[model samples]
Target: MSIPHEIENYIKLQPESKRNDMLELHERILQNLPSCKLWFLDGKNEQGKLVSNPNIGYGSYLMKYADGTTKEFYRIGISANTTGISVYIMGIDDKNHLPQMYGKRIGKATVTGYCIKFKALKDINRDVLEQAIKDGAKPRF
Candidate 1:
């Protein structure tokens, strides 16, 4: 039905460990983003083929394409993956920003340019992750 309902359903479908972790992360990201937009992508392409893990998104941004088209998208996203959970910080100009800034300090996680992935919340520096989300949440207008 609604985006929030869909997000709750997606999180509930995860395994016990992942379910708990996703719930915590969902709340944390909301707290950081405040009254931002919400999104639920059901991991399917237009043909309904599975293209990725279902993800919950927060906030909003304009994604500019090379051909001069712009699309509104989420500023931050989270999803449950096969091995762990992935957090996406979108609309970054540089691909090395996240890794270079928080790779070593953010605990046992893989800090890519636009994503920070970890097996569980306990495996990362909660404060560091929150800071990253906060930084990413700023409207890239």
Candidate 2:
């Protein structure tokens, strides 16, 4: 399958050591959620200044704010960080869900409420990570 130009560029821009990891993770995510929506964020502010690492997002959900406003956003996001990579699991109401569910099983990764940070794919258990991603993608409160 052809990836969007923006997402392609995002992967291309990563360091050599990280490019393959990004691509593999991207493909793994697709395999887990075939035909899911794809999203790319350039990590720029309105003025075009870089603010965060570029993100490759998957799936969709309507995010409600306290002020009653809502916006559509991705349910899962993958991004390259200075040290390694991060997988963001959005929309989980219980902040402890991730750590409690997958912390010990996820290998060397750091499991936070909505983010899984790791140095490399080899450092983490892919099967466990996949499970977390799948569970995180589901709608829950």
Candidate 3:
């Protein structure tokens, strides 16, 4: 699907009350990560176009690094009850690297395998998140 279509569809799914909040969050993300290529992912997996799981409900921006690699920058997503915003980094399977790089900034963030989930956007350090995104895009074996 086209970018605009994806954006519209994703927005349509949100309650009218949260539309403005979502847009503000979306714009903030774009402003923060200028080099990333954005894509709206079905975190909840209810779209039926891809996977269908309810544990995830969020939008993501897929950024491709200069090294020809890419990573996911999740803006905001809902999981049945809670809301989250996250950015994935290198060694998704390596816990040591994440904490070493992010430290306490990863508030309530739990990493399972390669997925990193933050409690909210405000809790994270944007600079660290940006570096993590760049690190995620770095060549990995």
Candidate 4:
């Protein structure tokens, strides 16, 4: 249940070719969010069925839902997909902000409303990615 254990397990479960990239991204995120909180989601549903890729999260924020409910969640997240990796930037009010700001500069990554996904770290710009993570961690609402 420890954050390091969970992160190690998740990375070990990834394909051989993806492990190093995952590790580098992990370190990069940690460097960008020094002293921030860490989170690991095993991608399991209540029944323990796999629903998503394991996620390593950083920072903290209160997520408010439409029904006026709120819960604490990470501000940024990193995960490995079947094809590659995904960096999630949560809590932004404008859905278009990420794509507009990072889309053109991030190289091969796909910049969506809240996610920047790419086949590998070398396929994208590390500086841009770090900036996105830093921006995502700030409260924008």
Q: Please tell me which model should have the higher lDDT, number 2 or number 3.
A: 2
List per-prediction Cα lDDT, in the order shown.
Answer: 0.91, 0.92, 0.51, 0.90
lDDT of 2 by residue, 1-141 (tens): 344788988888888879999999999999989978999888899999999988899999888899999999999999999899999999998899999999999999999999999999989999999999999888765
User: What is the TM-score (0 to 1) of candidate 3?
Assistant: 0.49
Residues 1-141 of candidate 3 have per-residue lDDT tens digits of: 876476766655665544444455556555555555555555444455645322222334455688999886543332321454333443344667766766566556665434566655556565665555555544454
Structural similarity to truth (TM-score) of each candidate: 0.97, 0.94, 0.49, 0.95
Per-candidate count of clashing residue pairs (backbone under 3 Å): 0, 0, 8, 0
138: Cα error in model 1, Å: 0.8
Collision pairs in model 4: none
**32-140 in candidate 1: lDDT tens per residue?**
7778999999999999999998889999899999999999989999989989999999998988888988889999999998999999999889999998899888866
Residue 126 alpha-carbon offset, candidate 1, angstroms: 0.7
Candidate 4: misplaced stretches above 4 Å? none
TM-score of 4: 0.95
Error of 4 at 76 (Å): 0.7
Q: Residue pairs in steric clash, candidate 1?
A: none
